[model samples]
Target: MARSGKDTDKRIKTGRGRTASQIRWLERQLNDPYVKQAKADRYRSRAAYKLIELDEKFGLLQNASRVVDLGIAPGGWAQVVRKKRPKAGIVGIDLLEVEPIEGVTILQMDFMDDAAPDALTEALDGPPDLVLSDMAANTVGHKQTDHLRTMGLVETAVDFAVQTLEPGGAFVAKVLAGGTDNELLKLLKANFTSVKHAKPPASRKGSSEWYVVAKGFKGRD
Candidate 1:
């Protein structure tokens, strides 16, 4: 729908040497209401609205004391978390450097590294009450390959959540449209009281991304 640009309220003029896909993306960004709202609200990215919608539906940030944000680039979700739970300690990790947020501890490194879990835990005063992962593997274009790579990140995030979340805590991670695999679902059901998938209104209809929310951790023992 955004490709034509002419039909939208805002037009993205095609720039020189821009590929068709890039032109379409610019058109979509220009036409997207969330992008305009994000600018007005001063949120880092439109992804912030996804977390806000999820929080409203699920109460994910309620009573949270410490939070861990995976793939926290651009810091939109963390900003939301900080605003919703002002006193909560936040530790965020990403491969890219994020501009500092006042009360957050940011680690710039590979979250898949062996030391990452300890690093994140140590940054916070105690085990996290909420673990959020917005990580997605770099897409290689092949659908199956992309799905597996993203699922791999989800699986690892689950493992970290199970290992580090306090009892009764919650874990939320981005997953593909079909949602978590059967094995992952079984693992989540076994470890948490409830698990569900959600696609917030902020997520574009064309996007395959959905969130897997696993709540009420049963403890690691």
Candidate 2:
């Protein structure tokens, strides 16, 4: 994957003993027009735009589509999915409980386990049209540890998506920029019509994370 950085916002203006890096991050967010627009638009987080950007680019969601969302905490991506397809079906599961939305049915469960895919499958009346995962482990400040953990989540999602998705279904999940396990990429390439590693404009300029979109599965099961 390619690593790209946006121009840093804000030179040192104040907060004389604070770390320059932390200060720059906060100022960048504050000055970001999208940040202000997201708040005004009532999006749960700025991360919602990543989904918005993807949908704009790929035409991912269709009317009356069935969707399964993993790691759906705070409901930002789920919200975007719903907004795009008001008539679509969405089932979201997360380790953290989310407030109910009228159109979305949520299960509070850890999706990293073996049984998690079955539970999501059981909830669905039929095969899903898209499986979207926005999961990431919060950084422990150890680069290698964080990278491995995020890769584990991505790998798990890909495994379940292989089993559950209908042919031509799309799978999207978040992966950090560096240290993806190559074995997993090989698997994705074999099954997906095309696999792309893309960073949506909505992702923070400083975030290490990017999303991988694997489209048009051939359906192994």
Candidate 3:
């Protein structure tokens, strides 16, 4: 709940821990491969690799598809989507401004805005073939508050998907690891052919984040 102080000195001494653990508290950026690859490819976040891994496992990104990316501030996922489909429709929305990336329509607005989804639809001309929501709230000192904020975002994203996802479309979003989002999980199973929870290799080991992917959307009333 409170930030992990499991490694606190005097409180918890090292007992022949692994090399990474030994120097973890003082570690600097020592060329994490995902970071290197992101720099090399000029993607926004090293988190791009998580999307790549998910795609490799599920082939979610398809040619000629329309995609909406929520909380795409750093734009790594947008970069991957554009590279994967040079001619596909891509719209990325975030609270912060982003330098333009080719083939993406960037909207500098909060996804929580009432008009946001409408604006996104206007940009896309219709429902999206895929919706990728990497939205995470800035954490407060309180873990329960942070979790609630994160779950709120996830719930909103799922509602948006239910309304605007095309039949057989996919919804991918970030979730916390302490508990599976129960109501969202149930909704996904009812409406999609498959719903899976995955923790990609690119996610930080210490982070509680994971991805929930619901695919093969069944159109709703």
lDDT of 3 by residue, 112-210 (tens): 999999999889877898999999999996988999999999999999988999998999999998545777789889999999999988888887998
Task: Give candidate 3's error at residue 69 in angstroms.
Answer: 0.4
The order by descending TM-score is 1, 3, 2
How does model 3 score by TM-score?
Answer: 0.86
Candidate models: Cα lDDT each: 0.93, 0.83, 0.85
- Candidate 1 local distance difference test against the native: 0.93
Model 1 residue 199 lDDT score: 95
TM for every model, in the order presented, reads 0.95, 0.85, 0.86
Residue 150 of model 3: what lDDT?
Answer: 94
Model 2, span 85-193: residue lDDT tens: 8888899999997998779889998997677888888886788879999999878999989898888888899888888888889999999986346898888888889
Instruction: Give the lDDT of residue 26 in candidate 3.
Output: 29
lDDT of 1 by residue, 1-221 (tens): 02343544766665789888888888888788888788888899999999999999999998899999999999999999999899999999999999999899999999999999999999997999999999999999999999999999999999999999999999999999899999999999999999999999999999999999999999977
Evaluated at residue 76, the lDDT of candidate 3 is: 94
Ranking by lDDT: 1, 3, 2
RMSD of 3: 7.6
- Indicate the residue-level lDDT of 217 in model 1: 96
